[model samples]
Target: MSQLGKFITIILATSTLALTGCASKNKKSQVMVAPLGVGHGGNMGGYYGGPLVNNSDAIRNAARNIQGVVYFDFDSDAIKPEAARILDQQAQFLNSNQGARVQVAGHTDERGTREYNMSLGERRAAAVRSYLAGKGVNTANIEIISFGEEQPAATGSNEAAWSKNRRAELSY
Candidate 1:
């Protein structure tokens, strides 16, 4: 063979080896992707040859076992006395389970504009997250989301319904 032929063969072999190396990498060592608040933990490693576990479901179920809802007054992000009690329980669970990741979802009544409601929702969620962090829960493990009036606990346009709608819910 000519010198050019030999050089071409070597390059092809190197490229093939590199591609094979990439394709054969261990999937177990790779991090798994989950939802916003669900961190990459638990038995998340699985591929065609391994057993796959539903980690997001597991995390959410675990978190659901506690007091996961806190109510707020109209147009207020302030933590009420009752809300503080609920947060205390949530914080204790989070502190005990350091690996647990929590998502704080804030919601508002439909009395305001969408933009204003969204901002209020964010403040409510942030307030809950802050309270949990103050109680020694890791802030990194907490995620906050604002649903505004999009997700309401109650459907009617009355004070009773609005009162129920103004709240934050926790999920893992």
Candidate 2:
């Protein structure tokens, strides 16, 4: 073959290879391939997978205004009197942020059976949800999830830990 023809062939091959490489790289970056039994369509065990809950600026501001999570007594599902003020603030925020939805996660200390704790956690979440609904927040926008004793705000088995665990977390 002529030198010019050979060079042209080489250039064409290299250009083709480069273009293929670029396409592959673009696909790699843009397309996320989840492993088997993962992603949105797959069953991620018992847990639901979706967007991470992020508190809106309004919700965060409201939470900050209220101070912090309210505590409940051991094995109780009732929201304490002190928590009413915080719930009131949260209710106001929910009422104002009509487009936002919230999830109330209930947790408990590692002191009871997993099943019992799960029930307790659910009750705790229900208590919070009921309070918010009573305060004029729409029930449709609020969800409840019970973590039971699986998740703990404080790890210790002491009073402080138990106190922190026996509460509901508001997420949006």
Candidate 3:
């Protein structure tokens, strides 16, 4: 090879060796990240310097204890007295964890038309967002979605099921 060709070849060889050496020696140590679910994506959780643990079960269990649910009255988006207390606790949580985000999902009973129920659900979610904002929680961190009557807490046409259905759920 000519002088220039030999220099280029040497550079390429060095780069290949350096890159290969930098590769992880243990194939088993490689981490495979699962695809993110629906919403504004990217690693919103930020970086964790520590080793990752598969604590999904723990998270699922602890989620039940987190009181982020608020019930509403029939055909009303207004925050009920009982719901206000629940919201207050949620507000406290959000206030303490400023970086935490929440998804407010509104649900309605199977009574009104799909369109009407969807609108009502949106209003319910908006009301919850407003209440949280009032309680010093950052509105920017809150996202609202209306599921309407599609996903009912209790499947029935009776008042008992209807009452359970009308609510907004907050998920972090």
TM-score top scorer: 1
CA deviation > 4 Å runs, candidate 2 = 1-48, 51-68
Collision pairs in model 3: none
Which whole-number lDDT from 0 to 100 does residue 133 have in model 2?
94
- TM, every model: 0.66, 0.65, 0.64
By TM-score, the better pick of 2 and 3 is: 2
Kindly list the per-residue Cα lDDT of model 3 for residues 8-91, writing each as its tens digit: 999999999987886556653112121223222242212233222222444435545678789999999999898999998888
Which has the higher TM-score value, candidate number 1 or candidate number 3? Answer: 1
- Residue lDDT tens for model 1, 77-154: 999999999999999988877777776778899899877887898889889988998999988787777767766777
lDDT of 3: 0.74
TM-score of candidate 1 against the unseen true structure: 0.66
lDDT of each: 0.76, 0.72, 0.74
Tens-place lDDT per residue, model 2, 118-149, is 77877888888899999999887777777776
Question: RMSD for each model, in Å, please?
Answer: 12.1, 15.3, 14.3
Off by over 4 Å in 1: 1-59
Residue pairs with colliding backbones in model 1 are none
